[model samples]
Target chain A: MHNQIFEKYTKADKSSLIPLLQEVQAIYGYLPEDALTDVSEYVKLPLSRVYGVATFYNQFRMSPLGENVIRVCRGTACHVKNSSNLLFALEDALNIKAGETTRDKKFTIELVNCIGACSIAPVITVNDDYFGRITTKDIPSIVKKYAGKTKTNGVTVTEEAV
Target chain B: MVELTINKIKVKAEDNMTILDAAKSVGITVPTLCHLKDLVPSGACRICSVEVEGFRNLVPSCAYPVSEGLVVETNSPRVRRARKTIVELLVEDHPQDCLVCVRNKNCELQDLAERYSLREHRFHGESKEHSIDISSASMERDPGKCILCGRCVRVCNEVQKIGAIDFTNRGFKSIVTTPYDKGLNVSDCILCVQCIVVCPTAALRERSSMKEVSSALESRTKFAVAQIAPAVRATLGEEYHLPLGTDVTGKLVTGLKRLGFKKVFDTNFAADLTIWEEANELIHRLVNNEPVPMFTSCCPGWVKFLEHNYPDLIQHLSSCKSPHEMEGAVLKTYYAKKLGISPKDVFVVSIMPCTVKKFEASRPELTEEKLQDVDAVLTTRELVRFFNVAGIDFADLNDSEFDNPLGESTGAAAIFGTSGGVMEAALRTAYFTLTGENLETMELNAVRGTDGVKETIIKIGDKELHVAVVNGIGNVREILDQVREGRSHYQFVEVMACPGGCINGGGQPIHQKTDKVLQRMRALYEIDKKMLKRRSHENESIKTLYKEFFIEPGSHVSHEILHTHYHSRKK
Candidate 1:
C-alpha cells in the first residue's frame, strides 16, 4: 500500500512532502503512524520532522477516520449564532468530543476556524453535505443519518468531495 | 564589515552576522532565551527583541541580520518593557517553585527573571499542567517548566541526530515529546542525555541518584564503596569555581572517603583491565579473521546505539564490559571476597561523567546471580551537590590516596576519558601482546583532537592498523555504512557518543563559559605524561590481579565476570 504512494512521486522528493502528505491523506483519510514511519525512511527525513511538518498544518490528522467527518464551523458568524452550543449538542448526542471519532466509526466531530460560508450562519458539515443554519435540536437526527449506512471505501463518497 | 550602533556603542561586525552575534562581538550582552550556539537560530522566543529607528515593531535580534547603517536601541524603555513583559509571561506560565526545583539557583530562566527585575507575574493564571515523565532510566522530562525554546528538540535532532523528541500537538498545547509520548526507553533514545545538556530550564535533567546514594550511605547492614571515573577528576573542579581542567583527583578521593565510603577506588584500574582484555579480544579476532573491524564497546551510549540502529553489526562490538562496569563486577566479586564479605553486602557506587552510565549500570546482562554490579551511579554534577549537602570542604581537604588492591592504574588508563584515548591505549597493549614489545613512542598524536572524526594508521608490528575515532554518535552512521558496504578497511574504531569524550559527557556541570572539554583532554594527557608507566599492560596491580584471581586475562572465569553480550532492541 505504501509502495503505491511512493510510485506517484518519482519526480517529487523531500521538497514535495506536503503535497505527498495531502495525497496520502486523500487516499487513507488520515495519516497512519506506520505509513508516516515508512515515509520518514523513504524521504530520508527523521520521524520527528515528518511528524512536525504534518502537525504544523491543520489538514493532516493523526487519528483514525470515522465514517462521517463532521466539521462544525467556529467562524465569527457561526460562533455569534451559538455554534458552540450546536457542537456541545453534537458531542452529547454522539458521546464523542470535537477532534474525536465515535467508537462505532460512524461519526467524527471537528471544530474548525472558518468555512468561508457566513451566508448561512452556524454551518455544520458532514462529509460533502452541508447542514447550515443548524440548531441543538438538529444534531441527533444529523448524527442518526450517518448511523447504519454502509459507506463507500469506509466513507460516504461524493464526486466533488475530498 | 558591517558597522552598526548598538545602544549608542559603535560596533563593527560581519555582514551576514545576526544582531545577537554582532552585539556579542563588542561585549554588549543581550539576553537570549532560545539561542543555542551552533544550532539553527529558532527565534521562537522573542525575548531578544531590539528597536530599530525606521521600523514600527521591535525585531527579534537573534534572527535579524544587521544592515550596514541600522540604528538600533537595545535598552530603551520600550525595549525593557517588552523584554520584561516577555519574561513575566514566561514566568507566569512557569511554576514559581524555584526554591524546591532541581535547578534552583542555576536555572537560566531564574537568572533572566532576576536580570529583568521581574517581581511577580502580571498576567499569571492557568499554567499548563503536565505530569512529570520519569520513564527514562538516565533522564527525566518535566514539560511544565519547558518554555518551548526548542533547544533540547534541536540538539536531539541536529547534534546527536537522534530524533527521539520534537514539538508535537499545536499552538498553546504544543510540547516537546516523544512519539505518542512514549517513554524514552521505548523510543530510539540511546539514554545519552545530550538533550539535557542543551536544555536551558529544568524541563530536561538527569534522573538523579542522590536519594539512592543517600539511602545506601545510611544503611547499616551494607558496606558502601565508591569508584571515581577519570573524567570526573578533570571536570569536578568547575563546580567549585576552580578553573576548568583543574586536576582535583586527590580532592575527589578525599571527598568520597570523607562522606562515609568504606573504600575508595579508581575506575582506571578497570580501564587497564579493559585494555588487557580488549586487546586480547582484538588479537583473537585478527588471528581468526572474524568480525574484521572490531568496534570498541567502552561507551554504553554508543553500544546501545549500535544495537538499536544496526543490529546486524552487533557482532563487531568487543564483548568486554565498559571500564566502570568491569570495576563494579570486580568490586562485588574479587574485592568483596578479599574483604571476607558477600557480594550482596558490597554496595558499589560509581561517579561517572556520562549520564548513560546510570542506565548502563542497571543492565541485567552485566549482573551475576541476579545481583546488580553497581548499586548506584552518580554524575559529576551530583557529586558536587553531595559535597555541598554533606558540608564537606572539598577544596581545602588534604590530598588523599586510593584504596589498595584495585587502586593502581597506569597512564593509559587515565587517558580513557578523552575521545581517542581508548584507541591509543588499546593499540599500545595490543602491540605489546602480539609482538611482545611496546612501541618506542607511545603518544598517538594523530588521533587526539575534538574533531567529529579522526582517522589514522599506526604500525604495530608487520601490520599497519587503520583506525578511526568517532567523537559523536552521529559521526558513526557514515563509518558504519562504509563498513557495511564492505568498502572500508579499518581494523579498529572508537566511538564516543558525546561530541568530546567523557570530559564533555552530559553529566557534567552546565553552562561553564569556556571550552573546558579541550582543557580536560589536555589535563588527562598531562597526567599520563607524568606517570612512570604509560601502557596498560605495565599496571602491576592488574598483573597481580590476573595471577591471583582469574589466572589469565581472557580465561573462562574472567569472561563470565568481565564480558557482556549484545541483543537487538525493537527499534
Candidate 2:
C-alpha cells in the first residue's frame, strides 16, 4: 500500500523524501513506523535520518490522527492575543495536552504556529470549521459540538465518540 | 591554487581546501570541535569560527571554502572571544563531573575549555537532564556529557554507513539518537562502537567488563584465563606512551598475569585455528560449487552488520566463530578437559581491541550448553583503565610469554589484527591445502593497504581465486549489493568493520592522528615478518590439537566446537 505513494519517486532519490513523506502522511493521516522503514529503504537513507526529518518538521506526526484535529494557532499575533488560555481551556475540556490525542481519539489538540487568519488574533480550527477570537468559556461548547459524533469514510456517522 | 592570508601570513593551498585546511598549511592551527578528518565538515559546533576581513560575521573555517585573496585571522580578538564563549557555553551545560568521567583528560571539550582558560561556567540556568542509555552490552550513551559535535554521527553515517543514530528534534532539544529515541540495543546498531571512537567526550564509551573480570579473577573456585587479541598488542602500547607501531605482546602477557589471571593465552592461536576452519570451509564451498564468495567471519561487528543489513547473503559468511570466541570455546572444552577442571569453573576473559567483542562474548548463538564462549571481554582502553586502577605501571613491566597449548600461534595469526590480514592468512593456508606446498612469498601486497576496499586475484594450484578485502563497513555495501544481484566476480571477501581493521578498532587507545592506525597496521606486519612459523598449517601446536582432539579441519567435531552459523537480524 505504501509502494503506491513511492511510485513517482526514484529509488535512492533523497530529494523526493519530503514529498514522499507528505504523500504517505496524506494517505495514512500520519507517518506509520513501518511506512517510514519502507521510505528509508526506498530513499536509501537510514531510518534514523528519516525519523530525524519527520520529528524536525511539525507537520509530520508519528502517531495516527484522531477523528478531529483541533489546530490552535500559537503564532506571534495569536500568542499576544492570549491564545494560550484558549489552548489551556481546550485541553481542560478534552483532557488531552497539545500534540496529543484524547483517550477516545475523538479529538487531537495540535499547537500550530499559524492558522493564517491573524485578523481574529486567537483562532482554533476543528476540521475545516474555524472558531475565531474564542475565549476560555467558548472552548467546552465548541468541543462538545464535535464531541458526540464522528465521520467514518467521509460520511457523518451518528454514534457515540467512544 | 587559492591564496589565503591566515593571521597575516599568506599561504597557497589547494582550491578545494577549506579555510581550516588552508590555515593549517601555514602552521596556523585553528581548533575545531566538529571537524572530522576526511569527512564532510558538519560545522555544528562553531569553535573554528574565524574572522574574514569582508564578512560581517565570523565564518566557521571548517566549512568555509578557501578562495583567492581571502584574508583570514585565526586568533584575532573577535575570534578568540567567540571561541572562548563557545567553549564556555558548552561547559556551562556539560556535566561538571569531569574528575570522575571516563574521558576526563582525553575529552576534546575538556581540552577546549582548558585551552580557552574557562576557569568558571559563566552561563548557568537550566541544564538538560538526559538519562544514560546502558541497554547495549557493548556501547554506552551518556547524553549529559554529549557536546553535539556530530563526529560520532558522521563516523556512524558516513564512515560506517550505519546510521543507527542521528540528530533528532531541533535546537536546544536536539540529540543524536536512534529512531524514536530508542535504546541502541533495540535499534539497528551493530554495536561496532565506531561512534564511540569518534565521539569527542565520555558521551560514548564501551560498557566496561572490569568489575566482572575483577570479581571473576578473585573467585576461589574459578580459573581466570585471559586471552589477548593480536591487534591489542599493536595499539595497547599507545596507552603507555610508547612509540607508534610498538608491539607490546610480551609485556601485555605479563600485565595479564599481573592482573591475577591464572593463565594468559593468545587469541592469535585461535586466529590461526580460524584459518584452519575458514580456509577449509572456503575450499569445501569452492569444490562443491556452493556460494562463490565466502566472507571472513572474524570481525564480530562485520558479522553483525551482515546479519542486520545483508541477511540474504548470510550463507556467504564462513561458519566459523571469531578468533576470541574460538579461543574461549577451546579453553572451556579442550583445555579445561586437559587440565582436569570443569568448564563451569573456567572464567575466560578476552582482551580484544574491538568493542563489539564484548557483545560477541554475550551472544547466545555463539554459546554451547548455555555457556557463553567467552565470559567477559575488555577492550584495550578498558584493560588500560583496569591496569591503572590496579596501580600496575606499564612502563616498568617485564616481558613474559603466553601459557602453552592455546597460547602458541603462527605468524599469520599476528596479522589478523589488520584489515586484509585474515584474507592473506587464509590464502596462505588455502594454498597449502590445495597444493601440497606453501607459496614462495607470504606477503600478498595487493590485499595489504589502508584503502577501504582492495581487490586482487591469487593462483592456487590450477584455480585462480578472486578475492576482495573491505577495510571499512561503509565500503561493504556496494560489494554486497553486487553479490545480492549475482554480479559479484570474487570468490572470497574479507571485511573488517572498523576502518583498517582491529588495529584502528573502536576499543583502541584514542588519538587525533590517523597515522597511528597505519603504524599499528605496520606493527602487525612486522610481527608476522619476524616470526619463524608464518603459516597456520605449520603450527605444531595446532597439529597436536588436531591430532589429540579435533581429528582434522572441517571434521564434525571441529564444526561442533569451532564453527557457528549466522542468522538474519533484520526485522
Best by lDDT: 2
Taking all chains together, the TM-score of candidate 1 against the true structure is 0.95
For candidate 1, give the lDDT.
0.88
- Give the TM-scores of the predictions, in the order they appear: 0.95, 0.96
* CA lDDT of each prediction against the hidden true structure: 0.88, 0.89
Question: What C-alpha lDDT, on a 0 to 100 scale, does residue B51 get in candidate 2?
Answer: 95
For model 1, what is the error of residue A137's alpha carbon versus the real structure, in angstroms, after optimal superposition? 2.6
Question: Taking the tens digit of each residue's C-alpha lDDT, what string does model 2 give over A1-162?
Answer: 577777777555789889999989998899999999999989989999999999998889999878988889999999999999988888888888899998888999998888798887688888777778777878778788888888433423222221
- TM-score, chain A only, candidate 2, equals 0.88
lDDT of candidate 1 over B385-484, digit per residue (tens): 8999999988788889899877899999999999999999999999998889888788998889988999998787678989999998878899999888
Q: List DockQ, one per candidate, in order.
A: 0.53, 0.80
Give the clash count for each candidate: 0, 0
Which lDDT tens digits does candidate 2 get at residues B482-554? 9999999999999999889998888999878868878999999999999999999988899999999999999
Q: Which pairs clash in model 1?
A: none
